[model samples]
Target: MRVLWKIEMWCRKQAAAAILPLLLVGWLTGESSQALTTFGKSNTQPPKEVAPTAPPARPCSRQAECAGISSSSCVRTHYDSVTRCLCGDNSPPLNGQCEAQSKLLYHVCANSDECNDGLVCGAPNITGNAQPHLRVLTPQDKICLCDTESGYREREYTCSDAEILKTSIFAIIFVTSLRKILFY
Candidate 1:
């Protein structure tokens, strides 16, 4: 009788352990089904569209006032007397923002500041005339050039010693090959 009672208690505990999880699963499923039914019957509206807002205009009276804006300065408008925040000499306004201009070799530029590092904006001596002094007057004539003060000679875009050595070797080989073919 004692053994039978112990076995009955163990069976009861086992049944409770198994039934508890099943009951919890059924409760969860019923709750989810009720939620689904309610969701289906509820009126759903389309999302409202939002309009984009433009940024507020920034006005300035002095260069310091334009310091918050990147690459900008206060300048009087050509059409109006009012001074406004405008892009600096090295930058131009694009898409309502000041953008720095990066001019490549021989590319037209407004000033030397617009040219990339190790380059200066100047006019090329295309007519074989005496090299003109560096000027920033005409945009059409200005181009990015090697900075002579940085040990870069005029018309040279690269200052790498390895590239120079390779070019010299190739030139020497070409010249010797041409001489051999001509004299031999």
Candidate 2:
């Protein structure tokens, strides 16, 4: 009788453990569905249509000519020496308007303004050791890199410049001490 009671109790505990999660999941799902139904629009309604806008003018000799277009300005192209309506310095023209590029590290950039804080758009070499072929490359080839002058330590991937100095000083002291111990 005691053995049967123990087995019954174990079964009851196992059943409760299994049923509790199912009940919780069902309750949560029901609540989420109810919330969605309460807040969402009816399926019978149609989405509103948006009016199409006129395309921006392409050719321009002055910024005033492109004033009608959003996020556009007049700039001279380096290749053809022709002044035309273009995007801002940091933004690139995409599909007819200026689009902002990602300013994160390692992302392709055209100028420093397109890069995040403490980063610059240039060759990755912080030591000025870029190859001759790479040196003649255009701005489009450049990428966002850490601005070492701003206290960014690329070797340690940190923003502390003092850490590198301390490390170098420690290395010099260690070498001198080792030399003294070996010679003397």
Candidate 3:
């Protein structure tokens, strides 16, 4: 009789656990869906379409002709034999302009913004050292480096100036300690 009571109590607890979650989820879902339906029904009108904007004008014949345009100055560029006045070198890239190249190695970066528009800032994950050592990169060591598959195929990581000095000092100390271990 005691064993039967224990089994019944365990079954009841298990059933309660299983049913409680289902009940809670159903109640929450019903409330949310009711609220969503009420909100959605009130906004029955279709969204209005907006006209597309035109790009900034690039109008010039001579290199000196484009000096008055906003956010862009004058520069001479040759395309297929015609030398014409175009946007200057310092102009920020336009909406459809392609990115120039991947981020160069060892360019100092605090975050992704300091790097080029698309490149991330991080070091490579290197292995295969004679001595197994764990390495943790600080904020300084994180430079404006390209992702691995973005044609930046350097096996080793690039470091900032401060990181270089710190790493070199640590390397010297570690080598000397290894030598002492070998000699003793």
Candidate 4:
């Protein structure tokens, strides 16, 4: 009787082990179907957002007297129906206008009002305004620049300025440092 009971228990245990995997499969399949029904497709990838990386300061090497070349102004050559500016330079791209080249890099200026600084103002969609959107360019697109500082390579981070009086890199750095020291 004891051997018979042992045999029955072992068989039951094996049966349960086989059944559990089937149960788990059913659950996972149900979940997958429900997920597909809810979202248009299965969730495989997360959404991507544009993040602002700290742009390195522009750097000047030993031989280079000029940090970056400067152009007098960028003039636009054409706009289908919405754009208005008369910029001609292909180097620095302007907002709201189609770039002559797509692969060329341009810097992120704050706005057309102050694009020399790094700000990504959106482009416009309506009529009459020359630029449809802010055609933020990569630094390579910037045509002209003064000599950059030593030790700090010309990085196109969040817009920084040459003169402390002109912009707020001083105040921002000071306040951020103070907060870090006092609170952190």
lDDT of 2: 0.54
lDDT of 4 by residue, 1-184 (tens): 9999989877876776665455445544667456435546666768889786533222222112121233212222233222122222333323333343221112222334433332223332234542322232222333222123322223431223355443355656655675455334
| Each model's lDDT | 0.54, 0.54, 0.43, 0.35
Ten residues in sequence with the least summed lDDT for candidate 3: 130-139
Q: After superposition, how far is residue 32 of candidate 2 from its true place, in Å?
A: 28
Could you tell me the TM-score of candidate 3?
0.19
Q: Count the clashes in each prediction.
A: 0, 0, 0, 38
Give TM per candidate.
0.26, 0.25, 0.19, 0.19
Stretches of candidate 4 above 4 Å error?
31-184
Please give, for residues 72-178, the per-residue lDDT of candidate 2 as tens digits. Answer: 54544333344455564423355666654345444445689876676777864523674332233333356566788787744422234565578668767765675
Which is superior by lDDT, 2 or 4?
A: 2
The digit string of per-residue lDDT tens for model 1 on 1-184 reads: 9999989877876776665445445544667455545644755768789876544336554345655666554444334344455564333344557665465454455689887676787765555353232221133465567777776664423333445667668767765675455334
Off by over 4 Å in 2: 1-101, 126-140, 155-184
Q: Candidate order by TM-score, highest to lowest?
A: 1, 2, 3, 4
- Backbone clash total, candidate 1: 0
Clashing pairs in 3: none
